[model samples]
Target chain A: MLSLFATDFIENSLMKFIQTSGLMAIFSEGGYKYVIMICISLLLLYLAIKHKFEPLLLLPIAFGMLLTNLPGANMFHAELFAGGHVHWDIFVGKAGLIDYLYLGVKLGIYPCLIFVGVGAMTDFGPLIANPKSFLLGAAAQLGIFLTFIGAIALGFTPAEAASIGIIGGADGPTSIFLTSKLAPDLLGPIAIAAYSYMALVPVIQPPIMRALTTKKERMIKMSQLRQVSKTEKIIFPLVITIIISLLLPDAAPLIGCLMLGNLMKECGVVDRLSKTVQNELMNIVVIFLGISVGATATAASFLNPRTLGILALGIIAFGCGTAGGVLLAKFMNLFLKDGKKINPLIGSAGVSAVPMAARVSQTVGQKDNPSNFLLMHAMGPNVAGVVGSAVAAGILLCMLG
Target chain B: MTLFVIDYPLPWSNILLIALFGIAIVFVVLVVLVYIMRLFGYVFTRKHKVTNTKAPLAISEEEVVAIVTALRLYNSALHDKESDMLTINRITRMYSPWNSKIHGLTQMPEHHNK
Candidate 1:
């Protein structure tokens, strides 16, 4: 009787342990997809920490991917997201903690909020001093259009193609904003591709920039940018907001928040508010945005063939955008005088990756001529690229969404 | 006529056309912005130049010297003569979380005590 009781107790304990184990779900439920996704997440984490690839967002995103993919964790419920439509009631009541935070992304709030912080931090002086850089900024968006065509060729929807193409703009927030609205289903792949390519700007842009430009072009020195007055700085954001809003209302939210932040910064009385927006608000939103965006990279969505296509197209978009900017500069040089010739390398800074692309231009230019300081000159196109990409996103939203 | 208007089912012709149109719009808008910025620069700089060229007040050198001396004496009398730089000791205090501008929506907490 004692022997029989002991056997029964052991059997019961073993069955309970097997039933409750996460490892068991890996085999029985998620199967191979779970293993593959876990490996991908680990790879992303390695890239984020070991390689220091945009770790601010990448680390959270990678961890979120890991958390959601762990079999039987029930952290992210796909049923809550139905056919590009979020069932808020289900998400709120049935889903895990991460799902609630993800609502900001689903509703396209986080990216716009991030733009507000970006605008507050950005100085429009460089752009205002040399307004012609706006052309380079516009020219850099060529990759977005080119990639849109490529995505379509690969059988993606117009909406999906538009989202993918915006990755070329190299602005992470703009990419997320457009993707959330146009092709929410492809948000994870598109956002990751956008950010990953943005982090890779220092690597990807230099080779193209060097190949396209002759030694003379790289060594060409630009004139000093003029100092912009406070009045012009204050007026810039307000005027831009009104003009862009009138032309493309779809861009208004992103542009409007950005301008509002800039206005607060330039208005001179709201230093405290501007500082808060730049630091605290930006940090908090980035944390939430990173984790939530990462959580969306499920095996079902991320492992698809479409994602592979997007990753491929993203690099092409970035490369083409760089080329377009450089080529435009060369084209403009034809019209310029001997002393007024613009450095073709400055044009590569026009892809909206901000200071990174601009810094890369400076680095490459300095390699050819150590005395050359292209930082400020490159900043003109660099900042203009932000406005250009926002405008491009607005146009895409107007056309496709 | 609208060339290759975007609609559901996303035809390649429409997608290509949209891309062209999109690029056109980006260029046109930026061109407009560039011109506007140039206009602003012209107006502001021209105004600045005009202001710079305006005649100065006709104060004699003696009067200017007198004014400068008086101002310097006044500053010396009121300010610290020993230290070139002003020293400030900030009060260290613990406050509620609401003191953070990030937390409080109404107003930022004052740095110095009233």
Candidate 2:
């Protein structure tokens, strides 16, 4: 009688409240391996907090990871890809509320939405002020190419190579954008690699930046930007959208969505929409995205050697892109009229890591010579890098998929 | 009967699909990279420059490059300084509070306070 009572305590209606009927049925394969991934996420969270890496994102991601791992913790049913996001017990075959939240991430909705916020917050003024920084953006993409080659050599198919190579760009939305459309199954690892590398931007970019530039080059100071007209500022996004749309129709969805958000902000007439996209929309999407993405990390899928390789290669891709951008800048300097000296350190800003790459450029420049500041100037290339990588991703999708 | 229940290893078709997915991502990253490089190259080689920090209010090539570097940070788009004031960040020298706008621009180390 006492044993029966203990069993009842272990399995009671109270447990039913926490876990939905749908979760009670399914046989979760690879029990122990799954636990390891949960541990990995815990480690990442601890490292993020302890080392003070991107705490804002890492902490949330860690929490999401933790919630996803506990048995019957159906906070979100994790079938976000199918549109019905509710926690469900596979055993009893009943879905719950947790699945609803997973819908946003599984469908690859959140990152794109965050882009709207990013688009709103972005200022193309510096790029317009200088316009030349776009080259650095192009240069930063060099790592993607080198990484692609490496991925292929490592036995990744052309498609796998492209996905892995994109981690070099350091833009999470684009990574999710491509992975979701191309390889839904690999989304979990790819997303993990992209965000992990993005959080590690400062650590990953500096050595390559310093190795490529001399103290003299780091000390190079640029002139101020010319005043841009409002009309010109307004026309810029429109012109880019038109040209890119014509160039890569397949890339239209990703580029179109990104530019549409940017256009709303730059046009200056849609202040309300831009504000919504930047604040409320971005916040809601980030929460859903973090949780859904965490659910995909089932141990069976995430524990492959390929995942490890992708992570390692991601670092290389980022470094090479930074080096590529800086080297290109230095090469350009040779042809540039006497006073035009491009700071190779700013070349690191060529990666699509956005503000982080720009910050790295500024920090490195300031450290070498406090008098030297490269933040605003790096914008020209940083935003340009974003556009460049998008076009590249679009073209690849067209050719391969 | 046992043979019918045997586990089928994950397929090459799945792997192929996975590889195709990767290609899409790299392509985007590269296109973005090249476009940025070209855009900056155009700005760097612009016909007229406004002022170089070395010389007040006059745009020199060095100043052009330096300003481009400074302006690049604007790429982050979190310009709390002018960001608070206007979405359009451009202002003519006459409108600036200081006639020596470029003079103290890099001086005083404003970001140092942060």
What TM-score results for chain B in every one of the models? 0.44, 0.32
Instruction: Tell me the tens digit of each residue's lDDT in model 2 across A329-390.
Output: 89888888756677777778878777988999999999979988889888878887787777
Off by over 4 Å in 1: A1-17, B1-8, B55-114
List TM-scores for all candidates, in order.
0.86, 0.71
Error of 2 at A286 (Å): 0.9
Model 1, docking class: acceptable
Candidate 2 Cα errors over 4 Å, as ranges: A1-30, A74-99, B1-114
Which lDDT value does model 1 have at B109? 52
Against the true structure, whose lDDT is highest?
1
Best by TM-score: 1
Find the number of clashing residue pairs for candidate 1.
0
State the lDDT at B84 in candidate 2. Answer: 47
Model 1 superposed RMSD (Cα): 10.9
Candidate 1's DockQ is 0.29
Model 1 chain A is weakest, by summed lDDT over 10 consecutive residues, at A84-93
Error of 1 at A341 (Å): 2.0
